[model samples]
Target: MAVLVPYAAARPKTRLSDFLDSPERVSFSRAMLADVVDAVVDSGGNPTVLATEPVELDADATVEVDDRPLSTAVNDRLAAAADDGDDSTAVVMSDLALATPRVLSRFFDADGDLVVAPGRGGGTNALVVRHPEFRVDYHGTSYLDHLRVARDIGASVREFDSMRLSTDIDEPEDLVEVLLHTDGRARDWLLDAGFTVDVRKGRVGVRRER
Candidate 1:
């Protein structure tokens, strides 16, 4: 299967700006992207990085720079894949720090013309598009919009439910999940940066050592 990993290199993980500085945010974002790409490769899928700007990464994938909005860039790839008669193409978010090969394999093997893995806060974390008419819209509540788009095109839809696949690291709170559940580069980067899980009032959060 062909996998498209969308990445914003210029200004990534803006929600974590309060916790991480500009350079650190870019580094952390690239770490998560590497982890996601590794998972996709291990799961037997070919990945292409659709980046906003040129980026240097230690991943075995092709880099394609498309400065267009997320939806437009992804749809263009989807259309091109359809024209090429590809069996199925997947759009995996670059920030899925917790994604593993097992989770991605299950998602790729799911039986559906359109398989969606919804992220926290109604975002579409990952999706496999087999229907030729299916396109993506990355606006607000994009998960719901994807489902509606699938239904309107008469494509069979399946929602793949997996905690690892659902978690995309964008906010400072999300860093906790990577530290707790992941053993990849993202987790290592956070740990090396002195981020540790802190429980306050029975709620889990991250604390960076000074």
Candidate 2:
């Protein structure tokens, strides 16, 4: 099976703009992608980065540049691969900093026509497509759309759940999870940049200590 890591190179992590400037967002997003790529490589899968533009990644992976929205790019690639007789392809998110090789292995070893790792707030974080009829939709509540599509097409579906795959760092609340559970490059970057978890007024959150 081939692993494809899709990334938005031009403008990544826009939701974190309030916390990180444009350059900082790009740097942090790249760091997270590196961690994900390392985990995919460790899991014994060949990884190809699918990017919106030509962006250099410091990892042992190939790049496929496509100047299209994530959903369109990924769908086109998957369809083309299926046409080329590639039986299985896994589309993994680039922000899974806490992902481990074991978790990824489990995902690839799952027994089904389709394996899905659903993210918080109705997102599909990672997906393994073994059936030719299964395509991807990444719009709002995409997990539900994928499930229905798989069932409609008579594909056996399996949902794989792990903290590593599910914890995609998209929002500020996500930072708390990374700081508490992960020690990857993203976590190290946050720490080096003076970010800390703060507990006050019966609430838990992140704060810049510096």
Candidate 3:
């Protein structure tokens, strides 16, 4: 499945998104996007090179999906990715702190025409469509609501336990969440970058202790 992460100067932010000011946090977010991609690539049991790209890189694998607004740009890219409909595709958001290798494995196991990993707030963190045009009518929570759309299109639909998918880092609470679930590179970076990693309140912030 293919993953989609749309970013910009003031990227794809939802009202309840977890965000931070430190560049380290931002950079970690970028790295997290790649780590998640690696996990997805490894999930392929066969010879799939795994279409790879960064949220900030330039390439045909990516389209300017952030320019057209939230879901529109995403759906537009999905529409574009549809050019090659033979591959099972999964579009993942870039903000999920809990996104990990195990989560992706579960997602691959529950593959269907459409599979959505819902975020804490409205909208979704990851969207998986087995093929382009898998669903003709996509609007509203079609990302999360694809279950019904898949049925309408006679396509299979399912939602599995995922490592809470991250979309855009908007709200401060998410920063806290990121620290709790994120580890290794992101965690070390946050500590070194002077961003206090607090999860007691279930949020991440930039107030470093001492």
Candidate 4:
């Protein structure tokens, strides 16, 4: 199975803009992408980066630039894999900063026509499609939307649950997860930028050290 990682090279992760400036966000996004690619490779899978634009990154993967909407670009690859008589294709989000080889191994080893690892806030973080007719819709509660799509297409769906896969670094608060849990490039980048996890009033948040 080939893994496709969708990366938004141009102005990625706008939700973190309040915490990270434009250039910082870009650099952080690349770091997260590298972590994700490394995890895939370590899990014995080849990853292809479906980037929106040309991106310079130090990772062992093939880069394919497709500026189309996320859903369209991903579905095209799914369709192509189906046409090529491939048994399955996997899609992993680029912002899975905490994902490791062990987490992805379980997701990849799961048996189903449509295996999904849902992200926080009703988004899909990763998925493997064995059924050729299955396509993805990324807009509006895509986790539920994917389940519905699988049901409608008579595809067997299995949900793989893991904290690492569920966490995709997008919002400011998400940085805390990387600080607390990740031991990869993403965490190193945040620490280098003076970002650290702060605990206050029994709540965990991220704060930058001046």
Q: Decide which is better by TM-score, 2 or 3.
A: 2
Residue lDDT tens for model 2, 1-210:
699999999899999988888998999899899888988999998899999888888887899999888788898988998899998999999988788888999999998899999998899999999999888889799999999999999999999977778888999878888788777788888998789998874668798777
Query: Cα deviation in Å at residue 70, candidate 4?
Result: 0.5
Candidate 3's residue-wise lDDT over 1-210, tens digit each?
A: 455654433433343333344454446655555555455555552211122232452222333333455556555656766785546656665555456667666775675777777655555666667756664333355455666566666877676544455433446555555566667455565577566755466433455663
- CA RMSD (A), model 2: 1.2
* Ranking of predictions according to lDDT: 4, 1, 2, 3
Tens-digit lDDT track for model 1 on 10-74? 98988999999999999999999999999999999999999999999899999999999999999
Q: Supply candidate 4's per-residue lDDT for 14.
A: 98
Task: Give each model a TM-score.
Answer: 0.98, 0.96, 0.66, 0.98
Error of 3 at 139 (Å): 9.8
**Candidate 1: deviation at residue 180, Å?**
0.3
In model 4, the runs with Cα more than 4 Å from the true position are none
Give the residue spans of candidate 2 off by over 4 A.
none
Candidate 3 Cα deviation (angstroms), residue 77: 4.1
Residue clash pairs of candidate 4 = none
lDDT of 4 by residue, 130-188 (tens): 99999999967999999999999999999988999999898998999999998999999
Residue 44 displacement (Å), model 4 = 0.7
